[model samples]
Target: MLVPLTREKFEQLIPLIATGPQYKYYWGKFSNFLQRLLISVVIGAIVLLFKVLFRVDFPLVFIIGIIGAFYWFWGPVFQASQRNIKCRRYKYSGFFRGRILDFWITEELIGKQETVNNKGDLVIVENREKRINLEIGDDTGFIAEFQAPLKVAYKAISSGQWAELLVMSNRGDLSTIEEISDIYIPSRDLWVSDYPILRRDFFTEVSSRLDDNEDEDDKPRRRRSEGNRRRKRDDYRY
Candidate 1:
């Protein structure tokens, strides 16, 4: 079933910003930063030791760095997947209906911080381009938040446009959307009922009943009837 999300309903359902302070990069604000620095130093020492001991250009060290960065940046999703695998889990989820409160698209130039204003429109203030984050909110508060790409943020989504975000609960990840469009959910019962009408079989039966007209040709009348039936069907749909 296609359930359209109007602007009012969208605002009502979407969540607002979480209360209190939050650690954007990692858990345990101060300790996490120290731990990260210590880990980086340890890794650097290990790289140096490897170079001294092996006496070889470790070209693959950069590859390991890349992989580590990937894991660190997306640790939640990777950890969730590992947990699901251990538990032998499977899952199903309902369509999350929400409007595009706003969206952030990355660009090469510098960008700024965006906010949901009093009019419920997403706005950005001109500034530096180092930070990256997107906040989705409703009347209650901000519901969803995701870190965006590194660069200028382009096109904060307009307020009150209907949209549905399909998600997989099993292997959750920061899978971003490229495009969105209407998705049709067909009903078996509706298809069976409309098969005859769509096939113009009703006109076939009407033509058969009119075959007894001897003085006049029934083909013209049948064609006319079929055309009328098609027009009626179109009008009913709209």
Candidate 2:
């Protein structure tokens, strides 16, 4: 069933969708190939171990050779078939729109460093109010500590390129994106829910306008502030 999602919720999902499983499907063939190769190696190792331990003279080389060939040629084909089925299921299932906002990569420890200011003072950063620390182990054990404005973190589970349209609020805190399966927006959040008022193309236009506003206002404010600070410092006596 489709559950209604706010604009903030949708925006949060986009990054996850782009860098998530749906995106991974773009190179699904290569991923499946590697999985097959790894499985083949494990099987070959087990067979060789059995032959050494049991002294079974069963045509070990022929069996292992055939297993390797099967995996190398057939694994990806099977995975591709499975992927297609899964895609269809999701298509029929409820879907949502999630748009990607800013994307950045930083060292894992930067979050810790930011906790305290340069003056060795404890600084309380408001955004970290409900921060959750996540330890994910894949490439290596790394900590992910951040506030996912809405439920955007849920969408990050998949990997690859994604595009979405999100909702924005005047305060910026309540803004979010929604993900569309294709180019068309779904009628409802959950497949069974009644359609809410649809605001197509709203986020894209809003974000552009917001960006333009910030660019225009920032330079003058920065220049005036810098000049004021310099004048104050110049008037100060040692």
Candidate 3:
């Protein structure tokens, strides 16, 4: 089931901000931090060499500082900006309730590590980690696949659990899902995703409003059904 929210309301709940729990997921990763530092160092070294060997001007040296600053300080902000831009292109935000149809685990290459062999030679080895993949769908026939690292908490997830999503899509084309937040499993009170996107507090508030709307919509239909039953009873007596 899909309950639509206006774009303005959606943005109000999920504001475009550089720092949040979602940004923490990107900023807190040690591997990502190391990778960015390595790039900055390598580029800075090259630029320094240009200045020393080829007599490049001060602008080139200044560029090295800028590169380091970008990778170290402004990287997360840049990433957040890009995500916000992509999300803004979509015209609608929807509260999607669905069920987990199936799931599987697979070993994925996470990264590589350098290790010393018995012969005292350094060698690079592939690091593999387990990841869980899930297929979720609703009665409306919309199906989406989600993946997350296989952790102890996620091991409890099985088929037939309820899944909730904050889905973004264009008004003219709802069939194509532009983006989705982390999957929320209400039964287990667990969330699954490599990256967190939605603001949990705001999500809970929106969910309640949607549920109330559904209840309000059902009231008239229920009253009409009762009236029909009363009419049928009178005709039978006559």
Candidate 4:
């Protein structure tokens, strides 16, 4: 089940949501210029073939160029728009607080010796991504991996600090980080401020559901304890 928030509450949180990285269409690691050109050429070839075989007068360049732009550029822009919109509907999926347990950048070499006419010359390429492992909720035992952006949250990562991570639980477990900020651990003696309340509340929201399961597990033990106490009392009465 997802947490319910009023429109006004969602609006209040929207600004904070804006603080996170806006949606970006995850275009595969293929370079933009190559993607565009290859797509355009394929589309152009098809358009030209159709024009020749069917004896159509349409200019192949115009048809293919427009289609290429749509697929390579406009399509992704539209997808990004839809993703951010979907975020509104799934807002509850974005609220989770965790302690950063570990962080690492994924590095792999990509080799592409073929396609000579394509953009830049690169026989060997290296890919990198920041992978952050987090321990969520009161159950410090609960852990998950989030593929976060390397450019953001370097200081906190280096300092080994706790964070209020607004993560997106996509298809599976919470894997993508939507936003993150360093949160100073509040001293218990000090009053938790508004921000602190927001911090504490979101974490509780994520972890509280688990507490229900814990409650279910404790019932048997609790009953046994109660039984033991009653038995002891009866013995004393005798």
Candidate 5:
């Protein structure tokens, strides 16, 4: 079942949604550049050590110059040039459909649902247990299983509601999800091409509901004031 919030709440919560991949790509490139820069420094130091130890006529000036050029120019240039490089585009035709709403997980509940396919006398069974439920928060409140929970969480950081998440699992367990809030999402690489329309719809409904609630709250006050005015007129006439 999709749950809708009022407009005010939707607006407040919309900001909490994770950011798209475009933002992640930018940061990812910057991080890669920093890593490369560090590696280059280490390589330069090794080259310097080799020149001193071997007493070889290594062109230290030329090598250092190239490294410097890569650091100051090539790194940023390569990153900027690749900005327009398209990775993979998802076609929203069939097979994959539906938008992602709110994602939540409780440690207490494991996979409970399972299904079987019927074929004549024999049947093939499979465990369709849901470890994570992605809430589309709409009229139906559609919930779906998230196959890649960690990736979903990473995407959620960009969506803006990273603080609401609380991950818990056993210590030393690599598969366990850990709660780490206030995480900065790297750039564009973090997003998928297929945008979740369900999430958008959910927020729209939430915003509408909030507006309705506000109107309802004002109605009673308006009626009370009108009643008081009527009572005052009656008292004066009497």
Candidate 6:
């Protein structure tokens, strides 16, 4: 299902900027905080070495302090700005309803982790994790493939399960999809992605409204048989 997102619907979706998982990005995660601290320490150590070796005057304390302060305060602000820009980019987006054509999982190496062995040696171990892949399509003949971290809910997803997305198109006709939001599975009440793209509450409300309207318009009605009508007309003419 595809519906053009009008100005009214777009306004309703504006609140999404302040909702969902704000810490989905790297800059908003705790690991980024630790990385910044490590970087500041390394820079401080380099400054100390320079002062001892060349007798150069550099405010080592002030330099490291500034770096730490910038990272600590600016990271979240930058992440928010990025998200806002993204949401605005899809202001003219359309709503899409599709079905899961297929799904599977594969193992991939993410990175290497460091650990100490019983022999008192540090070793790097490869980190491998399973990622779920899904193929979704709709009546419009558009098909899309998405892959993300494996979630427990994904196990229950089978073929023909319903899914939803926010689709961006460059044309007014909304014929071609330029971008898409993370897939939302209504059956599982799960958004199948590592990061959240849509505001859960608002998205649910909008989807429910659209679904109800579609149901009302698609209700079946009885019609007289065309073959019987044509036979009666021919008999009357003869």
Cα RMSD for candidates in order: 20.2, 21.6, 8.4, 13.1, 19.2, 10.3
Candidate 3: clashing pairs of residues: none
TM-score of predicted model 6? 0.67
TM-score of 2: 0.24
Q: Native-vs-model 4 lDDT?
A: 0.42
Candidate 1 lDDT (Cα, whole model)? 0.36
From the highest lDDT down, the ranking of the candidates is 3, 6, 4, 2, 5, 1
- Per-residue lDDT tens digits for candidate 6, residues 1-238, read 6777775565465443444354445455577788766765666576667668887766865576566545654555556557655666653667778999999999999999999999989999999999999889987698888889997877778999999887776676677777677888999887887656566677788788777765654555523376854443233210
> CA lDDT of 23 in candidate 6?
42
Global Cα lDDT for candidate 2: 0.37
| C-alpha local distance difference test of each model | 0.36, 0.37, 0.74, 0.42, 0.36, 0.70
* Residues 90-138 of candidate 1: C-alpha lDDT, one tens digit per residue: 2322223344455454443465788999999998877644333344434
Error of 4 at 200 (Å): 20
TM-score of each: 0.25, 0.24, 0.71, 0.41, 0.24, 0.67
Q: Cα miss at 50, model 4 (Å)?
A: 1.3
Expressed as tens digits, the lDDT of each residue in 1-238 for candidate 5 is 1122223332232233233432343335566768867866776677667667876775765577467546633554444334322111111111111344555544433345444546445443443433333432123332233422234544343232211111122332213323211111123323222222123333344334444644664675555565764453333210
lDDT tens per residue, model 4, 78-107 = 444454455555433443334546556653
Cα misplacement distance, residue 193 of candidate 6 (Å): 1.3
lDDT score of residue 36 within candidate 4: 62
Between candidates 2 and 6, which one is better according to TM-score?
A: 6
Instruction: List residue ranges in candidate 1 displaced over 4 A.
Output: 1-27, 65-89, 95-238
Residue ranges of candidate 6 with Cα displaced over 4 Å: 11-20, 24-30, 37-70, 109-127, 220-238
Clash counts per candidate, in order, are 8, 28, 0, 0, 34, 0
The sequence of per-residue lDDT tens digits that candidate 3 reaches over residues 13-96 is 556775476566667678888877887777777777777898868875877667764685567766876776677677877778
* lDDT at position 9, candidate 5: 34
